[model samples]
Target: MLRHEFHPGKLVAGLSLLTVAVVYAGDAGGAWEAPWFVALPLVMAGLLLAGVAATIHGIRPRGAARPEGGPQGSGKLGD
Candidate 1:
């Protein structure tokens, strides 16, 4: 099995940008009507959420610290 890691903030930002592109494309192609007020606010909200997520993620420590003051290498998969 393979593991994947991603920053929630970056994901949100990227999705927001993609959505903005979609809105613009749709409007340009006359596929649907996207009011500037709604689209702009949606983009803004996405950016704001991303920024908040990034700030929270930045302040936290990386991976879990090893168990404290117990036994060495006891937590390994193989005993």
Candidate 2:
């Protein structure tokens, strides 16, 4: 199972930027206006979602670290 400390600060920052871009885009009135207003939020949301997925995937426990001396299965030459 995977375990991760979920952090929302970065997501919030992205959302804030997205909001600003949306408002700026909204002020520019034209046929191309609404799509531009929406583009930033969509891109920001995708990036943040991908980051969250990566963090969750990375935290899964695999196994113990290797022993210090050498490989585990190799028998001594003259035991």
Candidate 3:
């Protein structure tokens, strides 16, 4: 196991993608109907939300306090 700074943008992006996958999976499994148009909007909205989240996180002022032993000054989104 490992610990690191939590990135909400990434989390939201992942969840959004997962939700889309589940919906299509359900359709494939014959559980329900999911039209092609549904996926287009879903993916676009997810990307928009992810971009907003990342922008928010980037603009947030860095506080004096941070979790001890965390990586510092990585300057990368995936860090």
Candidate 4:
């Protein structure tokens, strides 16, 4: 098994999302608020952060590389 190095980008992205979540949670019931407002931002931020973290980790030296012609495989409609 290959061991991967810890990626600072991933850590930073995760921590940033966590910070955003905490901040939003704390101010969830302020005067300027609407249904799903807080939840939407939080979810979006979480997803963005997760994507950043995943990208960082996924590209690490020991991680799996994208298959030949890109993520969809062989660049073909039906492979």
TM-score of each: 0.60, 0.38, 0.71, 0.35
Looking at candidate 1, the ten consecutive residues that score lowest on lDDT are 61-70
Clashes of each: 0, 0, 0, 0
Worst 10 residues of 3 by lDDT: 61-70
Which residue pairs of candidate 3 clash?
Answer: none
RMSD in Å for all candidates: 5.0, 9.7, 8.4, 11.4
Q: Order of all candidates by TM-score, from best down to worst?
A: 3, 1, 2, 4
Highest TM-score, which number?
3
Q: Over the stretch 1-79, how does candidate 1's per-residue lDDT look in tens digits?
A: 7966558899999999888889989998999998877677878999999999888877755433345444655655775
Output the worst ten-in-a-row residue range by lDDT, candidate 4: 59-68
Which lDDT tens digits does candidate 2 get at residues 1-79? 9976555555655766776666666667442445444666666776777677667656665433344345654456653
Task: Quote the positional error of residue 60 for candidate 4 in Å.
Answer: 1.6
The lDDT of model 4 is 0.64
1-79 per-residue lDDT for model 4 (tens digits):
9977666666666676776666666667573434545566666776687677777666655325554587656777777
The model with the greater TM-score, 2 or 3, is 3
Order of quality (lDDT): 3, 1, 4, 2
Which candidate model has the greater lDDT, 1 or 2?
1
lDDT, each prediction: 0.80, 0.60, 0.84, 0.64
The candidate that wins on lDDT is 3
Over 4 Å off, model 1:
1-5, 56-74, 77-79
